[model samples]
Target: MNIGVIGYSGDKNLEPVKSLKNICFEIGKLIAENGDTLLTGGRDGIMDFVCESAYKNNANVVGILPWDEEGNKYLNTTIKTGLDFSMRSFVLLKSVDIVISVGGQVGTALEILGAYAYKKPIILMRGTGGWTDTVTKTLIEDKYLDNRKMVELYQAYNIEELSQHINNLRGDVNL
Candidate 1:
């Protein structure tokens, strides 16, 4: 299955929150070990960190780029949407079976909303800060978003829990 990771691309320095970056790395490693493909925005922050770990672990990495720009050396496959950020985000969310949100800003929130609109399952890594934390606290109630029974929002406090949740979703107990 392809899992899309959406989060902060960081500032001009391209520096991600240290602790959140570590969590994203572990999540990527787990995804690879479980024989899953990794998808991302193909920029910096959580996207770069997770893609790097997934690549090292020999997972297929697909980057949904907003433009035809180069410099995404980590991605095994690149899909240049040739669209603006918002439209590109829709493609990213639509291409994946599941979506995972790390710490992020407006972009991440848009991705999450896109996932919901697509009716794709989403797992929010709590305590990672940014909009992810806010979503965990506000937007969802009783694990459902906006009383939308068709889509359920899941929260994982750590990598282990996140792994278990993914495994459960796949009906694999061995992971």
Candidate 2:
């Protein structure tokens, strides 16, 4: 399974929100342990955390880069889209079977919308704040977006629940 993780790029200092970073790292570790691939925007913040953790665990990591820039060192396969962020975002969303939204701003909102449009299953890690928190509060009710009942949206408050959700989807009966 190719799981895409979307979130903020943060500042140049890469001062991360400790809790969110830890959750992302744990998610990455779980993904790797489950023998799944990790996809990201190929930038910083939550994306960096997940990709790095996955790489450390010897999992395949793909990065859909926005431009022809140097890709993240942890990426196993880096696709230089040569397109702007918006276009690159589409590629990232299209390449993943599932999306995990940690904490994000406007860009993360766009990725979530893209996942909805693509009919991809999404797991919103609640308590991560930013658009994820907002979406969990209002946009999604009963695991479906308003007027879009076909969309699959799951909420995971922690790493264990997130792993269970993904494992269940993968038909891991033991889960």
Candidate 3:
């Protein structure tokens, strides 16, 4: 499966950087260990952090870049769309089977909406700050993003929960 992880791609000196890094790292490692392909916006912040972790753990890391600029070195494959940020986001989400949102601002929110519009399952990691922490509040019944019910949004407070969600989505039912 191809899993896309999106979040902040700005200043890395924020107060939550350390915690976010740890969370992103675990997410990356989990994706690698599960032998799933890892996809991202292919910029900095959450994207770079998670890609690096997954790369080191032997996962197939792909970065969907907005333009001709190079992606993080950790990416094994890079797709340059030559499109602007917003346009590139849709391309990225459209290629993924599922998406995981960490903490992010407008860009992350846009990606989340794109995933929803594509009807791809989204796993928002809570407490990582930014949209990951606030998007749920805006959801209808904390599940559906809106009246469309395009897709049901799922939340993961920790790595374990994230793993479970991925497993469930893959239909790896233990029962």
By lDDT, who's the top model here?
3
Candidate 3 stretches greater than 4 Å from native: 172-175
> lDDT by residue for model 2 over 56-108, one digit each (tens)?
99999999998796666889999999998888999998888888998788989
lDDT of 1: 0.81
Ranking by TM-score: 3, 2, 1
Candidate 1: segments with Cα more than 4 A from true spot: 11-16, 171-175
Looking at candidate 2, the ten consecutive residues that score lowest on lDDT are 10-19
lDDT comparison, 2 vs 3, better candidate: 3
lDDT of 3 by residue, 81-141 (tens): 9998889999988888889999888998998888998898999999899988888889998
Per-model TM-score, in order, reads: 0.91, 0.91, 0.94
Cα lDDT for residue 142, model 2?
A: 57
In model 3, the Cα lDDT at residue 144 comes to 84
What 10-residue stretch in candidate 3 is worst by lDDT? 10-19
Q: Residue 68 of model 2: what lDDT?
A: 93
The candidate maximizing TM-score is: 3
